[model samples]
Target: DAGVTQSPTHLIKTRGQQVTLRCSPKSGHDTVSWYQQALGQGPQFIFQYYEEEERQRGNFPDRFSGHQFPNYSSELNVNALLLGDSALYLCASSVTGGELFFGEGSRLTVL
Candidate 1:
């Protein structure tokens, strides 16, 4: 994905822990979306933000939260982490709910 990237490509955490992952959307894209991909499973939508507002969200619990910046960059924060939270967290960019281009993702492993 052009201009889309994530930080802390890999990380480790423990139960009851919390982590914040960051993403920079593609240039000119006004929306950012987050996804969680467990091993051997397809990505699951976590949430989407635009205009610095959360515009859409998936079925994930309140523990999953995010924010979008004025520059279109974004962040995903997961609190009270569990082993089950281990996954590749992807950040995607689009134009107001248009087609998406995804970053490589940040891998999180919990023990």
Candidate 2:
């Protein structure tokens, strides 16, 4: 079975720009979570989606948002990007509250 997958492996954006990253969850998975990993720091949860509904969110600002589709694929969107927003955006999938399987991650660089 295929693992999680993310598109646009790398991206470059300017401050105030918006970007969207996409992901396809692992087979048989139904929950998707998004994370941001700044250089030298561990992943920080952004939000989680299940059953096409957002279930939990972290300390991130409203500029961070996500969507999960019926097929369990997901998208992460960041608006008004800032230089500090540059990081490895990760997508993880699993059954609700279960162990997570992570994607290769989408790297975003804001200038």
Candidate 3:
């Protein structure tokens, strides 16, 4: 069975640009969460999506946005990207208030 999966396993972007990352949740999951992990640091919660609505968010700036589809897949969009945005973007899926299953993550590099 397929677990969580992310796209563009690795990507590059420049400061002031924009980028979009995608994720597909594991089967039977209805909640999707996003996180950003800097080198040597634990992942920072970015946001969570459920039933096509954003249910929660973290301390990230307004530049970060996300969408959840009825199919339980999601997309993370970062506008006017900054060098500080460089990090591993992780996607996790689970039933609301249940155990989270994480993906390998998509590594984003900003220059």
By summed lDDT, which 10 consecutive residues of candidate 1 come out lowest?
1-10
Error of 1 at 42 (Å): 0.8
Best by lDDT: 3
lDDT of each: 0.93, 0.95, 0.97
Give a tens-digit lDDT track for model 2, residues 1-111. 889999999999999999999999999999999999999999999999999999999999999988888898999999999999999999999999899999999999999
The positional error of residue 108 in candidate 1, measured at the CA in angstroms, is: 0.1
In model 1, what is the error at residue 63, expressed in angstroms?
0.4
**Worst ten-residue run, lDDT, model 3?**
8-17
Candidate 1: clashing pairs of residues: none
* Candidate 3 RMSD to the correct structure: 0.5
Candidate 3 local lDDT, 25-108, one digit each (tens): 999999999999999999999999999999999999999999998899999999999999999999999999999999999999
For TM-score, the strongest prediction is 3
Go through the candidates in order and give the C-alpha RMSD of each one to the true structure.
1.2, 0.6, 0.5
Q: Kindly list the per-residue Cα lDDT of model 1 for residues 5-65, writing each as its tens digit.
A: 9998999999999999999989889999999999999999999998999998999999999
Q: After superposition, how far is residue 53 of candidate 3 from its true place, in Å?
A: 0.5
Q: With candidate 3 superimposed using the best TM-score fit, by how many Å does residue 72's alpha carbon deviate from the native?
A: 0.7
Q: Model 1 misses residue 61 by how many Å?
A: 0.3
